[model samples]
Target: MMDRRERKRPAAQPGSRRRTAALLLGSAVLLAAALSARPVPHEVVVQFGDDVSAREAANALASLGATVLWVNRSEGVWAVRMPDPGEAWRLYDRGAERVTDAKSYSST
Candidate 1:
């Protein structure tokens, strides 16, 4: 008679391999969906200099291909969206006092 410890272990079932592949494929699909849902054309708040008027600032930013979402006249800030992250530097060059990422102060 063979001792229990001396017996060979059974081979892995074929179903387990299929289940693992399925799990990996599902994870990949979910990851792709998540990546597609991420935000694009990042939002930013551009605070204009004291010398710049709201209309002037808006026109300037629009000329740079920024989409103006909102304008805070009292605060002298314009909330705009740009495709490239580095576009904030251009806003500063255009007479923006400060340019901040809208995501930082957003509730959502």
Candidate 2:
């Protein structure tokens, strides 16, 4: 006689095939939704210094419609607010950092 374990039937049956297909379709739909759903942040800038050079850079960035957070004369570098992690690189030349956090942003 065959061992009980060896005589066991296959896990999948023709009747359950439809259920398996439905489950696979459901998972695909969910994955697609998750991949497509994401938020895009708005960008702004906070310039530091009012000197000719600083003002020039500020004016250039102004056309982009970035909000000015602050202008500090004490520091010569400009502070631009990035809408997202991707745009943060735009401020590398002048120096960029997360306003809320201490993360540093620089090209080098």
Candidate 3:
């Protein structure tokens, strides 16, 4: 039996909030570290859609001063050299699909 004037008991311990905050901070740091562990790719491979012609894709890449390291015209795939990963957007604008990092490929 509880008194009407008695306050409700707190659901959580006083230290619980600090534990949650510390866990969140630790998780964030772990995620940031994990993401940073991967190497940044120096090049990317692009697969152009069927609607996009090989010549058109090639021209667009050339205009961007991007080197076409390797190309499989029949498959509509092009491995383009890009020093900056952010610059990969130029290829996307030209109708590229499955744009993936090709750091494993040799520039030669």
Candidate 4:
């Protein structure tokens, strides 16, 4: 006679297959949602030296293909969306007194 341990296992319940299919569908939906999300744009706050004119700063940023969102002439700051990380360094090399991430800020 066959041992109890060697006997074949019972078939899965009818509802289990539906549950598995639903789980798989949910997972696929989640994956699609994640894949469809776009990456956040890179933004920077560039401060120019006192001697740099607003026109000069605007020209420089335009030459780098940056999208100027805002300009604070009194503070000599420009909020710009750069295409990539390397552009921040390029801004510095181009005459930015300081280059910092746009998200870096203090509420107070």
lDDT of 1 by residue, 5-78 (tens): 99999999979999999999999999999998775788888888889887778777887788888877474888
Which structure is stronger by lDDT: 3 or 4?
4
Model 2 per-residue lDDT tens digits across residues 1-108: 898888967687667988988999999999999877754444343333344366566664464444555555644444444435354445534433322211352323
Q: Extract clashing residue pairs from model 3.
A: none
Model 4 Cα lDDT, one tens digit per residue, 1-108: 999999999999989999999999999999999976754467888888888888888888888788999887474789999876576787776678888888993323
What clash count goes with each model? 0, 0, 0, 0
Candidate lDDT values, in order: 0.81, 0.51, 0.79, 0.82
* Superior candidate under TM-score, 3 versus 4: 4
Candidate 1 clash pair list = none
When 2 and 3 are scored with lDDT, the better candidate is 3
What TM-score fits each model?
Answer: 0.57, 0.33, 0.52, 0.58
RMSD of each: 10.4, 10.7, 11.8, 10.7
Clash pairs for candidate 4: none
